[model samples]
Target: MLGHEERYDVLKRSLAREARGFTLIELAITLTVMTVLILMVVPSFTGWLNNSKVRSVAEALQNGLRAAQAEAIRRSHQTAFVLTSATPAPNTVASTSGSGSNWYIQVLPVYVGETLDPNPMVQSGSFGNLAPNVKVTASPATASLVCFNSMGRLVANSDATTSTNFGTTCTAPTGNITYDVTLTGATHPLRVLVGLGGQVRMCDTTRVLSTSAPDGCP
Candidate 1:
């Protein structure tokens, strides 16, 4: 019911209100809140990312050890699980690195001159390519090489020729052989435990192994 001039004035006021979205103080407060929230989330996100990398590396190593054990049982012969920094190949004689990121499995000859398959490599896997920053360390340090007998149980191998250039020898573990996988920013480092019976499992290193805490490790 207003006149043209009054209608135009009302329209102008409405437009002005619409255009005045956020004040400078409001914008500054909003930006400060958002920055605080982001700061709170970044550390948690980074920790989660690092922990995921540790777990991924641990699981890969656990699966490789299990595959080696299964191969030994299936072939009804001795097999070697060697952790090395070198590239793995059927014809390659790789050495062991205690903190290696790659793993190689092969059927081992019973004796020095025994003739078996020319290419004894069963499987090869890598954790380095997946999580380069993650560190893998064996507990005994000398347990970079593990051997499994026909019965899928840990065994000792005195043969220096099993793995070349590293003087790696497979010795039966007195107890569980553990490989700790960790990252610098990770909150939950993981451990891949290889039992003397060739059982392989992954668990959190931050907790104790218990009925209530299945993800824990000793």
Candidate 2:
């Protein structure tokens, strides 16, 4: 019953409604809200990422230390856990460094004339390439090598061989040898503790070690 003009007008209006979209103001407001949300989340995400790196490095170091201790007990020989920047090899001398990013464990020559084991290298690991931003600091600052006796307890050693040599004298830890792993943007730094009794553990640096706070470091 409608005329041609009315039909045309109705069809155009329907098309206009179908083609409607957000205006410039609405689009800009939506983008601004998204930007603010991203800004708010970025710092928290960065902190979490850095903390995860710290934890990974700490756990790796702890596992390495434990492996060294277990090897010493298994072989009934003195084993040296040395932190060095040197690439670990079967019979290469590893130059020790307190904050070394790599760790090497080897059975030490006990006696002056003792024949070095054919394969002295027990285990090796690298955290440098994995988490370069994570910094490791030993408690004594100069203690880079920890030796374990046949009993799997911390011991003093001045062992040296063409294959492996602990650059510094391995001194028994008075209490616990702590390796603190930290990252620049991390809110929670972690510590790897090696006790005199050969106990290795990782703990949070911000808390006190107790029954309720087992994750805390002393």
Candidate 3:
């Protein structure tokens, strides 16, 4: 029962009320929602980022190794792939053993009637240095050097006893030199597996890449 002028005044008041900014309670509720959304999204994003970085590193390593192998075969020359770590605190083989930290592989051209060096000193141009933050601690293997002949065939690694304890170094098959990777803070840590055929494969602990049963690495 309002006149046109009275209706106009009422509508003006409603417009002013509607134009008011959010209240503290509304702001608090909105902030809570936004925080919840962020909390839910951040972990997934972080995991994805970490996983991508790990995969990239693994691929880079695998490609470098495979290329080195291929280059050796194509040119029929001695080629070596050196792995180094950023910080080496002298991982000891045993308390009494001396200088058990650095390790590497040397590709020696085998000649008839010539003796290949059985134990080449790591520092005697046997293995090269590793990349930044990349460390070759150890694995399940009998030797440190896995060599490939000029035909890209894995040289049958020497017969020796290797340590299987955690952080113990192991050599890849003589045919193809491969290495695995472990990322620091990834949600689903990725493992890189290299084949004697110089093919790089990847899988998580939860899944299998190869059709064959579980093994340390192919």
Q: Evaluated with TM-score, which candidate comes out highest?
A: 1
All candidates: TM-score = 0.91, 0.89, 0.57
Any idea what lDDT model 3 has? 0.46
Show the lowest summed lDDT stretch of 10 residues, model 3.
92-101
Residue-level lDDT of model 1, residues 132-153, one tens digit each, is: 6899999798779888999888
TM-score of 1: 0.91
Candidate 3 Cα deviation (angstroms), residue 123: 19
Give the C-alpha miss distance for residue 21 in model 3, angstroms. Answer: 1.3
Candidate 2 lDDT over 1-218, as tens digits, reads 99999999999999999899999999999999999999999999999988888988988898888888899999999998888877888767778887888998888878766886678787899996755578898887655888899898989886553334755678767888889899888899998988888888899988999999989988
Residue 135, model 2, lDDT: 88
Please report, in order, the local distance difference test score of every candidate based on alpha carbons: 0.85, 0.84, 0.46
Clashing pairs in 2: none
Off by over 4 Å in 2: 1-15, 130-132, 161-164
